[model samples]
Target: MTAVIDKKKCNGCGLCALYCPLDVIYMEDGIGHVVYPDECWHCGACRQECAKGAVRFEFGAMMLAV
Candidate 1:
């Protein structure tokens, strides 16, 4: 599984980047982007910490419904 960043919902607050323990998430051009998806620990820190609910888990062909 990998974390997906919603471009529409993301305000580029860098909260996910700050919350990510593995330093996988980063801000680029005022947007949240993943630097290394494989490095994700799946600890759900980025997803849970995002108050805007922009970050989500992508599992195969399905995405976590909030």
Candidate 2:
């Protein structure tokens, strides 16, 4: 899955970049962006930490069964 950043929602918080285990996300023009969307491992760590909900899945996600 690819991670998508909503330019309008991004606040340049740097949370995605910090939480990214593969270092795929980064900041640009005071906004957060996925530098390497293909490198994302679908770990969902960034999605949980992002306050703005800027990062999203492009291919849709499964509802993890509890």
Candidate 3:
């Protein structure tokens, strides 16, 4: 499983990047995104920390519905 970044909902706040304990998130083109999907430990930290409701998880072909 991995975290997903919704481009439409993201405001480039960097909250996820700031909150991530693993330093997994970053900004590109003024958008918050995941840098290392494989490095994710599925801790659900970023998903819960995202204030704008932009971060979520995807397990295989099924995404965890927010």
Candidate 4:
């Protein structure tokens, strides 16, 4: 899974970056950016912590298989 932030919806609250356990998110120009996507644990912390609901998870085809 990958975390994607919508720049239009993001309020630049920085909560996503703060809540990321692996420090995958970083703040730049007051916006949360996924700087280390490879390090993300797919824990959903960033998405959950986003008050504006800017963060979303994108699952790959392999993860969608049942």
TM-score of each: 0.84, 0.83, 0.81, 0.84
How does candidate 1 fare on TM-score?
A: 0.84
lDDT of 3: 0.84
What is the alpha-carbon lDDT for the whole of candidate 2?
Answer: 0.84
lDDT string for model 4 (11-46, tens) is 899999888888899999978898887787889888
* Candidate 4 error regions (>4 Å): 60-66
Clashing pairs in 1: none
User: Candidate 1 or 2, higher lDDT?
Assistant: 1
Worst 10 residues of 3 by lDDT: 57-66
| Candidate 3 residue-wise lDDT, 10-64, digit = tens | 9888878888888888888988889898788888788887888998887854455
| Per-model tally of clashing residue pairs | 0, 0, 0, 0
> What TM-score number comes out for model 3?
0.81
Pitting candidate 2 against candidate 4, the one with the higher TM-score is 4
Model 3 residue 54 lDDT score: 92
- Candidate number of the best lDDT: 1
